[model samples]
Target: MRLLALDRFTWRRIYWILLVFLVILITVWWQPNRTFPTGGSLARDSANPQQVKGAIQPIPLSVDLDVEKVALGEELFRDKRLSADNQVSCLSCHHFKRGGADRQTYSVGSGGVPGDINALTVFNAGFNFRFNWNGAYETLEDQIQATLQNPKAMGSQWNEVVEELQATPEYPKLFARAYADGLTAENIKDAIATYIKSLYTPNSRFDQYLKGDEQALTPDEKAGYQLFQDYGCISCHQGMNIGGNMFQRFGVIGDYFDPKDGITQADLGYYNVTKDEADRYVFRVPSLRNVALTAPYMHNGSVETLEEMVKIVAKAQLGRTLSEGDTDLIVQFLKTLTGEYLGGSLEKLALDSDDDITS
Candidate 1:
């Protein structure tokens, strides 16, 4: 009789579990005409982006950097000896004059091969929590190493790079000055990473405005900032670097990819790293700092102008259409993000580049 009572109790628990599961299933199930959430719920809401929280903060005026290591790294960064071919270097894709990127739709890598994705700006990259569009790398050093070994990029092995750097007349003594191990692979990476970390840009007009300098930004630029928040562009693009702290899907409201264009491996985004079906088009939110200067927007570098890209981002991600005037105001605000490159060498390079172009 006791066993019978226990069985009855077990059956009652199972019945309750089944009932709860059914209720949850019904709650989430959408009607045939009504679609479910695809991450555009915030855009659909009426709240201002600033009111919704997560407004971007100003990048600090200063950061710690290894002075000696940065000097050595800057020289190494321009050395083409790191790539398989003697023609390419880190500077090949990252030109300081062109907004810390090549300004190409897609960068031309080793052997003149076009990269599958856009070459992101290296300016203010130290502020990014993760590296790359896929966020495959958590450290700047890892990203540098990966780039060196990538078949489409440097296409060179560490042993090859080490051999070349050791052969250089200046590199040996420079590395020795910077490290006890001198020219070891790790030391090379450390020096380069140190230099890259020092590439922080600061004191943009927007940052000045953020710091309570009300007169720093023009009236149109201020209005653009408001529209940027109101249009929900600020939802993903917030925090110190403006947008590098999180990952989000490329097209939340509508499909951004054309299957006919032949989706390449780069288009897979975070899926390439995790192999998760849910991560199909997930990407690290890129920093909007210096974005006005970096043209050919999007991962594929398909969008041409800042105005067009703004509209595309609004429609594709937020499921909203913006007027031309609204986009124009936002562009004006974005122009204020082009800050001074604090590194003297980079600033000189920009000036020299301009001089060379005009001469």
Candidate 2:
């Protein structure tokens, strides 16, 4: 009887050990891998094993980049010589203080020509899986090339831009410092792209909440976040940039474009690139970071306010009519997403003359 009791106790101990091992394995597997641009891993919360993980992840506090390249890039970004008319620069549409985008419905390009679609924010653009409203370019380099050649945009030939920059005394020295093979077209693009990559805004209130701060969000904001998930907004708008990781049909539940208003070529979306009928009206989901500050939303920029955009998107995308109270809550939650850039709040740093465009 003594031997049998001892055997039973040993078996019970083995069973408990196996169960504990399984729990640890599952927890590790379930945890999402959060990595910084510099390839560093973010720390996990091991103490609260029971804490539920959300789909959205926080942006890294900082990125590792060459300061010289960043400076050169910034100089190139603001230089008007890249344009055919010498009146427009990258900053013409992508204003740093205006949420990295202009308040204009359709950004004016070279010679005051209006673009077909709205300009997406340059801030946190590095996190996007694809670039532009149509996901036309996979890399920023490719997009920059297209922009340089676009008649309505920069409207300058690569050869012309190279010649113009090479003639400049300051650019030659800047290029020499930033690149080994300096004053080349490729090097110029690389410098500008690197500078744009450094524009990530982190440490938003929502990010603080994600990093284990229980009081970072108010009760109403928490409820709004819950509603955001419940209403399936989290479906396409998941991951680090909140929405830039995937592409989805703008009108998932119903046709968004009105027959009376007529559909333009821009409304065709990715279909214009692939000529695929199935891809019609499909667009890359834009990042919601600093969304409150970037107004006149959507591809055509028809919607002027965040409130109206939310109402239209919920009905058109999810096929659900959100109550006024719920909409207010969601908007409040979105407001918390405005992050800090250069250790200052984007709200405070925004340009007072958001609508005025000198270029």
In terms of lDDT, the best-performing candidate is 2
Model 1 whole-model lDDT (C-alpha atoms): 0.82
Error of 1 at 182 (Å): 1.6
lDDT of 2 by residue, 1-359 (tens): 99999999999999999999999999999876442111011112222233225668899999999999999999989988899899999998898778989887888788877788888999999889999988999999999989998977898899999999999889889888878888998998899889889999999999999999989999999988877766667666778998888777788777887768999898888898899987898888888999998898999999998888889988887777989999999999898899988889998878465455564
Q: How close is candidate 1 to the true structure, as a TM-score?
A: 0.84
Candidate 1 per-residue lDDT over residues 155-249, each given as its tens digit: 88999899988888998998889898889989888888888888878888888898999999999999998887777777678788888888888
Q: Each prediction's TM-score against the native?
A: 0.84, 0.84
Q: Which stretches of candidate 1 lie over 4 Å from their true place?
A: 1-54, 343-359
Question: Which candidate wins on TM-score?
Answer: 2
What's the lDDT for residue 277 in model 2? Answer: 89
